[model samples]
Each structure stands twice: as C-alpha cells, then as structure tokens.
Target: MPRPLMHRRHVLQGGIGIAAWLMQPGARAQVAAEPAGASAADFWRLARAGGCVFLMRHGATEAGLGDPPGFRLDDCRTQRNLSEAGRAASRQLGLRFRDEGVRLSAVYSSAWCRCLDTARLAFDPHYPAHQIWPALNSFFQGQGDAAAQTREVLQRAATLHPPDNWMLVTHQVNITALTGAFPAMGEVFLTRADPQRPDRLSLLARLPA
Candidate 1:
C-alpha cells in the first residue's frame, strides 16, 4: 500500500504550513526542553535505537542555484561544490555520530559532487555508495519529471536496509519532495517509514546543523 500522492504545489504548500508551526513558541519547547548539549545527546540516543533513516541534505554549497552552465556530474569543478566551511561541518557531523556510538549500517549518496563530498567527509572510512537515484535529482529544470522522481525515492525509503541506522545524502528538492519540509543545509531529518504503506513516513525530529 502507498500513501496518497501530492502534487508539487501541494507539497510545497504543506511544507510551508509545517515551517510555520515550527516557528511558534510552543512548538519550539516541544522540540527541545533541555540545553543544547543535552538535547543533542537525547537526539542521538533515539537515533541509536535504529529502525530509522537519516535524510541528510548536502552541506553548504558555493553561491548558485542548481548548477552553473555546462555542469558535468563527473567534474566537481563544473558543479556547485561544497565550501570549505561545508567540508568542516560534514566532518564534525560524522564525528558526532561516531562519538555518540551511532552505528550507520549503510550510507547512500547522490552522485553530485556536493552530496558525495558531504558523505565522504562526514562518513569517510565507511565509504558511501554513490548512485543516480532519480528521486534525489533536481527537477527544477523540468516539472514533468518531479512525480516520477518523488515516487522512486519514496519506494527506496520503504524498502532500504531496515532495523538499523541508514543515511541518504541528497539535495533539498529531493528531501522536500518526500518529507514535505525544506531542510536546511547539513540538516538531518529523522524519519521512520511505514511498513504497510510505502509512500508514508513519520518525521521524528529535525537535527539542526
């Protein structure tokens, strides 16, 4: 079974609704009741419990929308890439998980340079398998492609490695399409996929950068 599909406009509108709720005072308290350090500790503890997936948008990118003219996936120089600070952030993220004893069973990444760089820097030594998951690719250039890509990503999430911590390093559009929320750069959305419904997932929490 799959959850009902939403149009792109509807998805973006729903995301806006969620963003509004997160800005309210009451919602802020619900997200974290303790100090920053304590809250982070609690976040990882839940993550360590497994049966969840970390949908991570790539780290900060160089100034640009999508990619520059004539961008080539094989060439990082041609693509909008990770800034120096982005690289550092990625490394720190990996260290956080390692220090907190979160075992990442698998790491899947988009083939884009920024995405690959983030995963490599953050989860290196534990190499991530990069692939061209259409669901994670940009559809800004073509509206007709969005629905297919969204479906593919949802399906993958529904059946990827289960009962363990897994990760997907992708772009904002991809994450937004599946989760109905626009995650910030380097932000991680902890999600649990519904076993009975491939298109449905519950957003557990947002791990800020």
Candidate 2:
C-alpha cells in the first residue's frame, strides 16, 4: 500500500495542537516523505547542494508539556529541558550532517533553552550556532509575537541562495505553520521558501536525525 499523497492544502489544514500530536511516543520514527510523485532521492541530492533552509525541531526534552507557569528563558530549571538521551541524539545528528558533508552557511536557534542547547551541542565546534531570538520560538501555547517572528525568519531565509544552507533550530508549531508538516523532536527538513509567497515553504526532504 502506498501512503496518501500530501497536498499543500492538506498541510495548511493541520489545525491547532498539531505540534502536540507530533510529540507523542514513537513520533520521531514516523517518516513523512515528499508528496507521492516527488522523488525522495532527488530531494536529498538537492538538499546537499545547499539551496534551502533546514527547519529543525529541538531534540527530546525532559517529561513535560508546554512550560510550567512563570517559566523564564534565561532559567533552564524553570523550563522543560533536554534529557541525556536527547543530548546524545543531538550529538549523533551533528555527526550525521558531518558525514553527509553538508556545509552550513549559518545555524540559528530560538532563545529557548532546549533549542539553544540542541544547536550548540549538535552543530557547535563545527558551526557556531547563533541565537535568533523569537524567530524560532514556540507559539502554540499562547506565546505572543509568533507572526512577527515567523515573518522575520522567512525574510532572512529568502535572501539566501545555493552553496549556503541555513539551519533553524525551532519549535514544532513554527515548523508546522510554515511548511504544513509537524516535525518530530530532532527531525530536520530541507525546505525552500517561496519567494512570491512568504508564508509558504516547500519541504524537500526529511533529513535523518
């Protein structure tokens, strides 16, 4: 049996809490391929050529949903953070990128501790991950300024071209909203922004975590 084809419209219709569904156990193992007729192999080949942005959800975090009340961005203890397994997975992910010989032009991360940690632990020492503030923050649980932040991220991505891949370590909601796909923890998607349509993104491939 073949998987159902995914249309751009289908992704746009993914309603609220889509991010929550993606966080379920075994979620990371679920592979979302290119729309039925698209060639998966070709997507990877293009991705390696570096003409797109890589949207990455942070690695697994300690047990929790959203954040505890009064969470502070500067305080890791007040927020749900990465577990040891998550750290190991992040490191392995970085090695995988290295193994692929993917040269990144820039790596940006949300200010949230988990995102910052993921980018640093995984891509640092090779690519210095920089903070892009709210550009990649989670807005699912009523975080404000999501629209503005997303616009900023997309705007930055549009200016980039080949031989330079931009990797953004962000939240699931943000990724879903942009590309209409809910990326699991540690999942990375090679995506290209539609210059004419700033709100739309074309998912090229699901890079192994």
- Candidate lDDT scores, in order, read 0.69, 0.75
lDDT of 1 by residue, 50-96 (tens): 86778898987665666788888888999989889889999999888
Cα-based TM-score, every candidate: 0.74, 0.80
What residue pairs clash in candidate 1, if any at all?
Answer: none
Highest lDDT: give the candidate number.
2
lDDT score at residue 66, model 1, on the 0-100 scale: 69
Model 2, span 1-209: residue lDDT tens: 34344434334433335745455444344434454544546556776888789999898777666678999988988998988978999999888778777888888888889999999989986776565667788876668665677677778788889888888998887887667677767778888877776765778777544
Q: Once model 1 is optimally superposed onto the true structure by TM-score, how far is the C-alpha of residue 25 displaced, in angstroms?
A: 31
Check candidate 2 and list the clashing pairs: none
